[model samples]
Target chain A: MSRIEVGQRILQEDLEWAKANSLLFHKHRVGCVNMISSPGAGKTTILTETINALSHDMRIGVIEGDVETDLDASRIRRTGVPAVQINTKGGCHLSAAQVNGALGQLPLERLDLIFIENVGNLVCPSIFDLGEHAKAVVLSTPEGDDKSAKYPAIFARSAAMLINKADLLACGALDFDVEKAIGQARRLNANLEVFVISAKTGQGLDQWCQWLRRLVSQVKILGQA
Target chain B: MHEAAIAEALLKTILDVAGGQRGRPLAARISCGQFAAVNPEALCFAFDALAKGTRCEGMRLQVEIRPVEARCSACGRIWTIDDGYSRCPNCSSQQFSLLPEPPLLLESVDFEDKTDE
Candidate 1:
């Protein structure tokens, strides 16, 4: 009996699909951001606020992923941007294949930016690559700053982190240490960019929008190059 | 939770590589980093359940977990860390980059060749 050596990735098929999706985005010159967070971490709220803040200057589309409802998609549609809802039917996280199917329904040519609101999960979603140019994680102050330490995998892979619900901290309703959160995240990912914002109060959103604009412009430039 | 999906992927990968090779898979060696957050027990359970009808039915999944390694850009010191708030043990710099590597990988597969008989 002879033993054969096969050295490859177990998720090679998924990785290939993710790479193809990325190429599709590049071909359309659209910047895609995969947004992940724990349930009730204000992902939908922050997404809506960000859409309202930048929809005029930049054309935006959204792919909402949920376990059972299209409620988030409806909210995004109210803001006048195209939205596609993907109900996973109890699936823990959205997979690359699912995202590829959703991309077909989106008007890629008309959108400069597409935000994929991943399943409200901090763990499983972090493990999958959805072909997004950047991964932005929302961590609400109410969820506690220790989450960065608790879920290091997500923090390590995120390109940018939004410390949402800062207003709650301002009112002393929540005791989240923003400094410690940023420190922990940075320790895991030294290049991670941290932004403290409150979606309800429109606090610190301008900078977030600016970063989005820059990312879109950079993607456009890369497409040209 | 996602271990099922990972196991399915593992099965698909093994089958694709072992494609009509005339042998059943005996074992697979996989490597995951501390930051991968994979539960080995859960993955094995899922793999065993999913492999019921596949060629990997009784295959063994050997997982190797590697510690998270970082190299300080400032001091150029390399260190392995188990905690999330990893600082270079030598220079105590927070400004270090994680060693570039895939968090999870199927390093190799061992399959017995049945054609020899």
Candidate 2:
């Protein structure tokens, strides 16, 4: 028997879910950020610090994704903001459908910004579209500047990349080159916004927070219709 | 593996196509682009395991990792990217775009008709 040929997309439903999430967020006037990076890249710390800095001015919520445990959600809650924990059960990344469900658990009308802390993965997380207004990557100094080129998939897709843990570079012990890193990233994505920040020392967080404020305001204006 | 979900999606898509048709699925083809985070081997394994005891069982799966194609925004030259991206081979312009396409796709599915004896 001749083989029947049918052309289709396998992840069509998932893509639809992501697009729906994006539309829902836009309608609600909420800015969503998908934060992705390697494990131990201080994603939790960055979240806590960013929440502390901005929670006073705007309403912020979090969707924490991890392989296991609700520790990050607990930390985010400590800042007095709502956080929903998602356990992937060893999954390497967060799916848009999962975040769609988590979005329902938060106070959407009261929230201006929502951050989805993707499972600490530089690779798999980049492929999934959570329908965020912006996709940001947090690269710590120790993970090396070479990562951008090595993992072009993520750097290429990210709208912004934060070089985190700048505090470690103060001692001149780590041989990470900040300029080289940005330069490498630019080769793949010239418009990519680069921020050299330390969540521990609060070095470049002002600019980071400013970017968020801008994104939130833009969403506000767009959602006014 | 991270491909399990993707594989599951593949299975579901196939079932949707095979619903009304009277046939046992024979094979399926997938194209995994360079930008996709999927590992072809892992995807195949996951699909095989998930398809067991299903109508799509014993379906041959072919996953090909397509080379990345980038276009020079200035010179309008498009070429396949063999390795890490840096500059255009023709113009050396860093201003280029990785031709936007889906990172992964189930390109096609092959089904066989069952004949009444």
Candidate 3:
């Protein structure tokens, strides 16, 4: 009996597919951002607001992933940007293979930016790289500031974080400590950029859209990378 | 669960390695991060069931879950952490780099070699 040490990545195929997606994005000069959050964290609302704020100014595409419903994708389509709906059936996270298929369905060359709204999940989605240039996580104030401490994996990997639903805190309906959430997330990733936003009140949407434009320009207009 | 999906990938990897060999696979060793949230039981169950009609039927599995380790970027002290707590024990600094950890890795495989070596 011989013991062969075959050190391999168990999800090599999925990761390879993700890599291919990056190449596709690079060739098309598309700025793909993967958005992650828990359920009811205002991902769809923020997307609609952001798209409404920037669709006329920049070319954007959307890929919505959910366990069962296409409602989010439908909502994104109302913003007049092309959005694809991927129903995972029961999968907790969107896989690289699934994203690859979605990428094929989009108008890659015609768009300068793409947003993938991942299934509302904190854990599984953070682990999978969908070949996006950046990962943006949405954390609503009602979810509590300690969420970053609990789901550090996601916080650590995210490039930018949106503290959504800040209007709740303004009205004294919730007591989410924005500084505490930012501190916890920054502990994991020192360079994390944060935005306190409220999709309902139109607070902080300008800065969020501004960041999105800068990222889009970095990849499309300048980097071509 | 993604366990079934991950199991299929693991089985495919082991089979690819065992391909064209004179003997069948006997055991495999893998490692996962402590915070990867993968349930070993579900993975093993899926692997065993998928291996039922193959040469890898009843294969033994050795799974090692490694804790999260980090290095203080300031004081150059390395420490192991249980989870998301990233503060360095020595320097009490949050400015540190986490050790690179792949979520899942198949380290080694054991197989019977029927052919003359």
The TM-scores of chain A alone, one per candidate, are 0.97, 0.97, 0.96
CA shift of A28, model 3, Å: 1.0
Q: Write the per-residue lDDT of candidate 3 for residues B1-117, one digit (tens) a residue.
A: 667788889999998988967788999999998656677898889899999998789999888888878788899998887657667889798887667765799999988879776
Among all windows of 10 consecutive residues in model 3 chain A, the one with the lowest summed lDDT is A216-225
- Give the alpha-carbon lDDT of every model: 0.89, 0.89, 0.87
Instruction: Enumerate the candidates' DockQ scores in order.
Output: 0.68, 0.64, 0.63
Residues A68-103, model 3: lDDT tens digits: 977899999888999999999989899989999998
Candidate 2, DockQ score (0 to 1): 0.64
Candidate 3: residue B40 Cα off by (Å): 1.8
- Taking the tens digit of each residue's C-alpha lDDT, what string does model 1 give over A1-225? 455666677787888889999999999999999999999989998999999999789999999999998899999999999999999998899999999999999999988999999999899999899999999999999899899888888888989999998988868877788998888888888899889999999999999999999999999999999
C-alpha positional error of residue A216 in candidate 1 after TM-score superposition, expressed in Å: 0.7
Top DockQ prediction, candidate number: 1
Candidate 1 DockQ vs. native: 0.68
Rank the candidate models, highest TM-score first: 2, 1, 3
Q: For model 2, what is the error of residue B89's alpha carbon versus the real structure, in angstroms, after optimal superposition?
A: 1.7
| TM-scores for the candidates | 0.95, 0.96, 0.92
Regions of candidate 3 where Cα sits further than 4 Å from its true position: A173-175, A221-225, B113-117
What is the per-residue lDDT of model 1 for residues B1-117, given as tens digits with 9 covering 90 to 100?
A: 888899998888888877857777788888887776789999999999999988889898899988987888889998887775667788777788888655578877787766554
